[model samples]
Target: MNSTTDDTYAIAIVGGVYRERCMRPAWQEVYGSAGRAASAMASMGVSVELYTYYDSITEPVLISRAAIEGFKFSGESIPKSIIFDYDHGLATPRIYSFGSRQSSLRVQAEQVLRFGMLEGSATVHGKRVVYDPQSPAKPEPFRQNGSTADELALILNYREARLLSGGVSTSADLIAKSLVLDGHAQVVVIKCGPLGALVHDGKSTDLVPAYRSRSVWKIGSGDNFAAHFALRWMEEGKSAAESADLASRATAYYCQSKGFAIPEIFESFTPEAIVPSEAFRNGRRPVVYLAGPFFTLAQLWIVEQARKDLTDMGLEVFSPYHDVGCGSAEDVVMLDLAGIERADIIFAIGDGMDSGTIYEIGYARAKVKPVIVYCENESQENKKMMQGSSCLMCDDYVSAIYHAVWTACSL
Candidate 1:
């Protein structure tokens, strides 16, 4: 008899429960995918059971938190992660992971209980399955061909989908459809950072937009989406698109509150839908103008990282330092101005209030290019003119990058 048939729990979440520590914006809490998802569903009034491995020292703490999350948990004592997430929320965190299941151990679904790289025909026998292959940036799971469930909803982040699809597809829609078209899943969802998600049900493919929340901490957001989707699509039997939209909304709530205490009436919440830049609709990506002073090592690091990060995120970036290396004032100014003219938006580092950066900000403003300034240690008086000019001044580094990308694209 499959344990899934019992009403003791609405869904079983099989994953890790790490002692997570995130910085940059300064967050001091601990939750792995399993704990985060279980907590999310439980808060939404769904009966959730978590099965996983945990550190013996934190077993008592896990039990106490599980009780508060309104879920039951059972797992073996094993070395777990003390993850330290950095300033880059979207990137992989530094994890001290411990598990000796080195050689891949195959497991038959037998009725759904999971996490780890244990890949096989492991979804529930007859139940609708919502599976997310990657957990925060855990080890890549061993690939096995073909999967089956009463209904399958396979969710993967951008990198995982690209890797799974062999990095051949140009777009998320293509990647998701390829997975479905091939037999990896009946329904596939590729999570694109700001562009939202691309969902492909064997028959049709669609782009579901991510909702805008006041604050965005991307650590366990994917886990929240997986949980919400599992509830709406698997338990309640909602349409794939509708379930994804609802899940996106719920994820926004998680980002907004930075916790898993989702309300039962979360559906009633309406968040602003992220609108991609008009150029994106036409398949043209907006160019980002990187404007900042790189006088010292720290300054140079930000400039370099911002350019690399933006470029890796699939944006056409024009960095003055990299593009126009050490040069005379005349040629550099001429080329820099031209680059700004070619760009749709600008990201300016206002730290130290460098004259050149301030000049670029003013130039961007005059050119009507959308500007996002990252200024952490500036006085309000110095920001008066920039603020009056309607520049989007952000104090946070990661947030500024995100703002620049989204702002540029939407322009």
Candidate 2:
């Protein structure tokens, strides 16, 4: 048997095998999986220790253990924290090997057995376990066939607490409820994007509405919720029921706000722990400029596609062709130039490298407003002009459009 005086609960955070890609390494490496969970727990005044394991994607060999023990053996440490066991199919043997050979399944089974053994030991020893059964892949409406293989494995079978996190849409909420009804968890906290969370303990479910706010940027909102809720639950010694309510409110507060500042209630929950709604933060909308020739239908199509994509990422786009009418070349150039100067970032189509497009590129460069060039196909003249400009030369319009949106948002 393993033992220690650290006195903090060992929390594990799993899931996000695919989401790790969409986010920058800075988001993961700096705000690590374990670190984010710990941060959430800390907000509730809970001292915790966190453990994180990435799904699939083989890692380097390390020491193996047979005994199911606590952090004393695992070497993880934190205060009383929420354990985030993200339910990626990567953890189970049969699921991981669904499309592969039985040999791979055998290896996965051994790993799960070891994990279960260790986890069982930890529970038997003494530690409050909270499991976050979320994944990067969006949960589909429980397809009998698609989720069949996943169901047989029972990946989330052992969680005492379930956190509905990471892209929690309506479909995800239903799945979270099913997990609870199925006995995979004793309590369920459903993270409802702007609305808040729905928390359910075996007997009852409560809809905890979010604290209202003005500004919003939902980049790492789920991570923020997991951190604050976990901390508040552990530190305050609140019941799972109370924790669910608090977590929902915390997530809403963070999502409605901006920046990564840790909330104060996490350290010590006093009567004042529940703060006013206006305490949340805000963000300024980004300004965008779309420049290109207005003659060709193909070029017009590319511009429209770019507009749609940029709008999706939350930008106030300024395109003269759309705002004004797609008129003569001279009129479009004049309007495009004016829009370019007022904008923070410029995405110009270099399909033809028309004199106007070339002039706009030079103008954007002169203003230092980050110009991104999009070419429909390989044109020597277009390629030469795009060389020094912050551009993406692609074989087709779709690629160019995607590159432009990505580049513009990055800046």
Candidate 3:
């Protein structure tokens, strides 16, 4: 058994730490997953510290569980973050409008950095640091601020990377170069969901393939990847490739179990046992636009299942949910329209009167594209406008998919 004092390696996590509220299907409160990465690292038996700013609503339970110690700055009020997750769907939308509250967090991070320098303790001064810019808007504040650590890891998703790179390139190598050359950080990791991650270590880059899971809860998968990778590389004396492989497996476990805690089975897990999901399979196939409302868990599940089934039938699927999340209304509209324009056919789940799906149906019709509508419980009210010569309506999802496959073949 490893105690905090016995652990030679230590980690410092700096990012948004707040309370999260779910506003879809039901209203419930949960801890922020991204903010809880320190705890995850601590559970792995590495001494961990956290530098964050929080308010009264922030829970103290995770702090003790995940970190050996923490430094917190008090804000005027607690930031309220909301997530719209539906049954562990891949595209869980989030609204993290933290306003000006995040601006002060960088100051707290700087203080922690200075304190580490003054203390000069092995755990405090030599700790590997993880800076998780929770949003695209939050990166600028930390970009130029000088913070030093034994090794610094910046964890970001594709969108956040694009924002930081000024839309130049989303490549992990390019982002890392920008960060290193610009004096922002020494190492960069760009996590592309489902496709895995790109780890750039100043000189070289490695592509880590994601391990497949039967069910996916993508809420905190990237956080798990970043934290575990840092632990393995810094604490366990593993190479970049080895650390990333383990981190990928750890993320797979987190997603599969839908738990914030790291699983014991991941310690012995290897990539050889992984079987990539059909979505990750490479081949040329007709692109089908999966147009529907993912506002509910049931709807998101249906869309996800349809995507997998359609992909299994050798048809490429472009799902709006997979691409867009908590963006501007214009961005959402433009992205969906572009996808519809690229797709050969549209598969819409018309269980209810989803305005967005209805608009997609009309758009596809105007574009002279074939539209397949699937409604589980048939009703005359919902079928009036859908009854047309160009549309195929099916009560069963499988029937709709078969019709879509046949339609694609004919085209």
Candidate 4:
């Protein structure tokens, strides 16, 4: 029986890589791509899972109701039938093929070794230095160790056995056919970057155009595209043509916005607005809310510096993590503390800022609080979130505080 009886359906992605030589970049690309797809799928209400047979530990963290099960690359637990999470309407039981099934830890280890390629060797400004090859450098015309035996064999065997034999015709063509013939999937899309995507079913093939963008990091874009398309397909439940079209539109919208790269989606957190009279008894000073994800080491330094900057500027600052005791609530909450509620201005750090911080921004703004939003990049999504409602956009925390303090004083 078809499992999608409810309003939503679960999708399992059983794709991953475990290359030995090109481990780091390979797995990084794979996980990064997959993570984007997973996030996109989540956005569209599809229960999604990625079962990668690699040892890399860079997979996306699943902290909410949705679960991403990571087994050892070759673990037996992964071979079971795909199933969706019934309670959450998440894709539970879908398995997408990646490579030879392997254990997760071993795959992770192999990924690390690939990452070690960064230390192999390189030339900088005429000085021959073994530059870290593992770092996501500009795509080179040729890959290192391209002539290795295993890679050669894998390629040769795949071409000879899979391509030459009666495996459809082209790899992508075969993949399109397999979506229907083997997986019983109704839609299949293969993205070709600038060339766009080629979508197909058993009967027909459609070529979709790629959206043009000014270039904000090109990492994980394909994953984002896939997830968007899959979820859209599930939601629309229309023809394959319509689903692919919606997928194309969604990818274009995401590419033009920041939700694909940075994780904060402010629309989801738009707090209930408060009347001017209900303002806190203690008058408003400016308070900045930091919410999104946890802080990275470098981001931590920036946050610390921002705190110092705000303190020097004589603005009252409240970081939920640093100042208030907050739990993992879905929406932001405003503490009944003295200075928080009456703040004249609100500041929020959007990138990976915890949920509490984000809530504070919404809470303050809902009360018509003047808000300043600072992010590392000038992402369109962040810009839109902070738009019109007394929010200022900033590149780094330093300028963010500066803008917030200035705006508050001017107000």
lDDT of all predictions, in order shown? 0.74, 0.43, 0.60, 0.40
| Superposition error at 71 for model 1 (Å) | 0.5
Candidate 1: residue 54 lDDT (0-100): 62
Q: Which order, best to worst by TM-score?
A: 1, 3, 2, 4
- Write one digit per residue (lDDT tens) for candidate 2, span 117-209: 111112111233343333423322222212111111122211221222232333434555676666544555655422245566556666554
lDDT (10s digit) by residue, model 1, range 305-346: 898878877689999998987678987998999999999888
Q: How many clashes show up in model 2? A: 22
Best model per TM-score? 1
**What's model 1's overall lDDT?**
0.74
In model 3, the clashing pairs are 39-66
Clashes (backbone N, CA, C under 3 Å), per candidate, total 3, 22, 1, 44
Displacement of residue 264 (Cα, Å) in model 1 is 5.9
Residue 57 C-alpha lDDT in model 1 = 61
All candidates: CA RMSD (Å): 3.5, 13.5, 11.0, 19.9
| TM-score result, candidate 4 | 0.32
